[model samples]
Target: MVVRRCLVLLVATAAHVGCTYDFDAFMPSGAIDSDLVDDTSSGDAVADDAAAPLDSAIEDVIADANVEASDDVSVETSADTSADTAADTSADASADGSADTGGATDTGLVDTATPDVPVSCPDPEGKALGTHCYFPLAADNWDKAKAGCEARGAHLVTITSAAEEIHVESIRTGKDRWLGLRRPAGSPIGEGSFAWITTESVTFKKWGGGQPSGAGECAVLRAGNDWADLGCKSPRDPICERD
Candidate 1:
């Protein structure tokens, strides 16, 4: 017993009909209503579900990008720091080299190689006389005696004055000693042609009569405290002197 609405039409003229209708009578059971269209909660729910996943995915992508950027920044920062540290080390090495150069320059202050000597001479003889010192010792020959005296920082005695001759004679302990008067084998006559092996000549002579032959001979102290010529190969004591 359902209630219903209907539309009925009666013909009043041959070409027209009067009509009455109830539009609600055509509605089906459970049909959609305009109020139901306004109620869109299920569509809102579906839209929210889709949007939530999309926002979550976008946030995850942003987080991954941030992580990659952070790693890149960290790597770049490490490279920059390593470069700075290497630069500092190079600067330190340069400073050390400069300091070494400074030290080398400072080392020049203490390079003394030679020292000064005194004017006085060293001799175990009695005393120094006339800017010279004398030493008396045994020697082999003219050359060997000269070598020995040179080893003592001296030369064979060269007597230029009578007092020097007497001083040399006074020191003679044994046999005759060699003097520094000498000349080449083939030489000119006169004392001017001879050279004193130990001193500069000032033209003084104390020869014994016809002594000091100018024929390739060396001089020696004779018995009379006078000079005499002798062969150079003969061994004799030497009176060494320093001037």
Candidate 2:
């Protein structure tokens, strides 16, 4: 006759766990030809040996379960790391692409920090280019000229395109005029790194050959054609612009 039995072993992780083990035993029945009482002990010993294998199998199952749990944890950790990396990448992309990608020039930069003002030209006498209008006035130093433009709800022009440059040249009746471009103070004034205060980008530039030779701190449209670096205090009429 044979009998089968199942045993269960419970394991625990920091979180949770369980496992199952089965043991089978064979027993002999009916009278034997040689009935040796001493042999009975041998039979019992053989049963113990068989049970040893069952114990070993249970241990093996538990070890395998532990390894599987550890592997699951490791996989989850790796997945979390990947998700974090992806999120960081998305944030960076949004930071850089938001401006140029969206039609709001410098939407990702300085312009975004300020209010989104709708550009409107109440006076049509001044030439309109892009989103702003330009007005040519008499001569004055860079600071005074900027102030004057401000008095009229405008600022010095910031040229960012070739078309705008051409328009300025076409209508410029007098000498060169001051533009809003400026070099960093305490830094080389005219070596050509400039920014547009009204907007966040320099879309166009036309500097004269050897002009700005690191000469002065302010920028001007010379002959309304090309740009040159000049002293900030130099007397020159500004091409006022407003949106």
Candidate 3:
């Protein structure tokens, strides 16, 4: 009866407290009971059932953490990719700009349209002679010849030395040519009264024999390579000179 009452008390306590115990494992071998052993097995089954939900909760937390980590990594990768693309674009633009600048520099350094020509003679057809240019004009009167020479920025040829006289005489076409020498009206038939039309001082003279018989005011270089006075209206080819 006492053992039966103790058993009844143990069942009452277990129902009231909602707790479990390993009754058979703690009991002495002489006091072991089969019903209590069955209760101990049931308690172990409840403990395992309670632990299963905790394990599932822990697994759920781990899975959520893994998902968040994956999202962070994806964000970082996307940001890095964008930065790399921007950097590459900037670099490419810089390279293109540098290439364009270099091309412009190379093109600007060279010019290819103009050429070189001689600088001594202003008239392209004039002959360059001993530091001057000489050109022969068509037959014209003295005043007209002087005007023509002035129009072309030149003057009638003036011979100042025997060497120049010889040089010009060699190039003459054997035609009577007008000289720049002229005599002022009412002046004597001497060299002192003559002046070069170009205003150059008369430093030399090679008059032909018995010349300046006071024919006129203008002078001429005769075909025989000597100078003589003549009428200003006489037609003769003009020799033009310029430095």
Candidate 4:
């Protein structure tokens, strides 16, 4: 019994030593596995950090390309606009040139159609008619004077100014000449307010002394600047006319 008890005690001690060694081995293995897991996680974090910069660089490159492309499009659009403006300017210039040419042609046609009329004048001494000058006709009635002047394509001289009256008087013959003087019938002046027979306004007036008496509306200018009021039907010398 003593020998059996000693052997049992020795076996129990050996078994306890074996259990402690196994526990120690298992603890070291678990620590190594945990360290390995932590190292792998740290490596993965570093790799992710390294790839972040690359992603940012790629994004920057893409952004630069997009900006460059947009700039290129803007430049192209500006060039096209410039070209269109130049074309429009050219068209306007062409239209202006065509208008100028057309205007020149029209002026040339107008110049060709209407010829200039020439002016002719006789001696400066006599009164100038339309285009001719003439002396006084023979003494005759007012009607006869009108007829005479009409025949020569002229009318009796209408005296406007004293200077013109003097001029006519200087050119008259010895006989009295009827002038273009008339007044409205039954007027307040009783024919004293005389006007030119041509119906033109009297811008000037010269009456002889002691002439244009009451009821003496009709009048005539003779040589020596002599003016006499007479009836419309009175016979007298008529001045020739010209044009």
Please tell me which predicted candidate would have the highest lDDT against the true structure: 3
Quantify all predictions' global Cα lDDT against the true fold.
Answer: 0.70, 0.69, 0.78, 0.64
- Flag regions of model 4 displaced more than 4 Å: 1-64, 67-69, 76-135, 183-193, 201-203, 213-217, 231-235, 240-243
Per-candidate TM-scores read 0.46, 0.47, 0.49, 0.51
Model 3 lDDT tens row, 1-243: 465346545544554446665655755665855665566556445455555665677689999999999999999999999999999999998788779897343445556777644437656346766677787877589999988887888888898988878766765779889988999888898767788876878888999998877998999999999999999999887888876
In candidate 3, stretches whose alpha carbon ends up further than 4 angstroms from where it belongs are 1-119, 122-125
Tell me which residue pairs clash in candidate 1. none
Error (Å) of candidate 4 at residue 166 is 3.6
Q: Residue by residue across 30-116, what tens digits does model 1's lDDT show?
A: 453554445434534544454565567778999999999999999999999999999999999878877989634444576678664
Once model 4 is optimally superposed onto the true structure by TM-score, how far is the C-alpha of residue 33 displaced, in angstroms? Answer: 11
Which pairs clash in model 2? 160-203, 160-204
- Quality of model 2 by C-alpha lDDT: 0.69
What is the C-alpha local distance difference test score of candidate 3?
Answer: 0.78
Report the C-alpha lDDT of model 4 over 46-115, residue by residue, as the tens digit.
4455556656776899999999999999999999999999999999987887798973434444345765
TM-score of 3: 0.49
Candidate 1 Cα RMSD after full superposition onto the native fold (Å): 19.1
Superposed by TM-score, candidate 4 places the C-alpha of residue 139 at a distance from the truth, in angstroms, of 6.0
Cα misplacement distance, residue 57 of candidate 2 (Å): 84
Q: Least lDDT summed over 10 consecutive residues: which range in candidate 2? A: 6-15
lDDT of 3 at 211: 88
